[model samples]
Target: MSCFEVVDPLFGAYVLGNAPVKQIATGFDWVEGPVWFGDAGCLLFSDIPNNRILRWSPSAGISIFREPSNFANGNTRDKQGRLLTCEHGTRRVTRTELDGSVTVIADGYGGRRLNSPNDVVVKSDGSIWFSDPHYGIMTDYEGFRAEQELPCHVYRVDPSGEIKAVLTDFAGPNGLAFSPDETRLYVADTGRMFGSDPQHIRVFDVALGGRLSGGEVFCTISPGCADGFRVDSEGNLWSSAADGVHCIAPDGHLMGKILVPELVSNLCFGGRAKHQLFIAATTSIYGITLNRRGAQTP
Candidate 1:
């Protein structure tokens, strides 16, 4: 049986008919933040509730990348090929240096502690962007139960170590990614604690100096909320959904869906060709080879 649901003729060109969704790993409490290190020929992802980051390779299989990972959620690579991570337990964002030392990127702002850094992405200009949501601190499941010191907002950190709240209106900001050209930003508002608020993704015009304008609803995901996503070279967004991965065009229309058996939380393009979709679902990791390439920064 085909694992895809074709909604538009354009999406048919993006997927392979014979490429099946393969289960790469299993037996995890929850998984998110799948990032590919093509140079290393490995994929690193967060087993959030397990409080560790796991690494997978085509030849060696799975291994522990980092235990007691501060309940890390989302992850991405910087322009310098350093590992950038959002940690819920630490309520901060961090970068793993090439020398194997962990550097604290962002924790508190304006003398107040951040709620919890949930998802993160690095811009081509060397600026780091992440989302602060209360999900990690709401209970002891993911991180320690503590008082939220800051509102749920998206922040950006410059190369000079300056942190600024770029967007502050989200009840809960989950996943985020930059357009291929870096002229637009897409952010997911999954509502406060995944509650009654609308589950939709918003797009904004990124101006010079990172000034944002024109934040309008880009697309609303159905059967689930948008958790994390990555954009392709054509600016089409492949977002996580309840049933599987939903492909949304730049014009804010649903193009198609890649049906999976589990609830997907996040995804990234991997493989030597950057055409493989690595997915972090509820309790396992899955991958599928696609005909398109991802626009994610190395």
Candidate 2:
């Protein structure tokens, strides 16, 4: 018996008129940072408070990928198919090599430790960008609290291992994704701690050579705020909100909702055809099969 029931008749609005089925993967504390591994035919996500990373597959059910994960929060795959993770416990963004070694990608800027690496994304040109907010460090549940030496900022790491602060004044930048064409970057100002702008998603024009400019308010998710999200092949943004999974079209129009019982934290597109959307909600993991494919990784 499936744990999900399609409450709305328009659940397939984002799929061009095709219905989808939702599957649930229960048992977790706080899940976030979901990334699809197409070659492995599985999905990996973080259980932040549990301090471990878990894997899910159609054939294998669920398993632990890594324990004592340093409170990893956000995850993605690089061009080389290596896992890129943001570790709140260690206060660093790291990359897992193919041979099982970990490389510290970024931990500090200007000789100061990062507040906490929350979410990350890799661009087409191989540049890595992430949001660093203090939410992870402010509480002991996620990571050890150390006095923050620098202000919260969003950073971009070049292919050469150099880190540069891109944006510095977000109340709290949580989840982020790039448009399919790689022309725009959408950031979720979750405002998880401070109720600054509770329902805003900001869009920025990706300037040449891995720079961002022309920041503008993309859309306001009424009734809920945007959490972690991903973009599909058709340029639709799939994001988590208070009500459920909201799909916003390329022109910033609300397409429909995949309502979940809990607050969704992050999501990724997986399955053989890349049409399966796996969501990491508050305490459980849920997935749905979509008719459209997700944006292929660059």
The TM-scores, one per candidate, come to 0.99, 0.93
Per-model CA lDDT versus the true structure? 0.94, 0.85
lDDT string, candidate 1, 94-160, tens digits: 9999999999999999999988898999888899999998999998999899998889999999999
lDDT of 2 by residue, 1-298 (tens): 3333243444444453334445568878899999989888888999999999999888998999999999999999999999999999999999999999999999999998998899999998899999998888888888887787778788999999999999876878888899999999999887747556555888999878977887687888756788789999988898888767888877787777777788888888888888888888888888777777889982
Cα RMSD (Å) per model? 0.8, 2.8
Q: Scored by Cα lDDT, where does model 1 land?
A: 0.94
The ten-residue window of minimal lDDT in model 1 covers 191-200
Point to the candidate with the largest lDDT: 1
Alpha carbon deviation, residue 283, candidate 1 (Å): 0.6
Name the TM-score of candidate 1.
Answer: 0.99
- Clash count per candidate: 0, 0
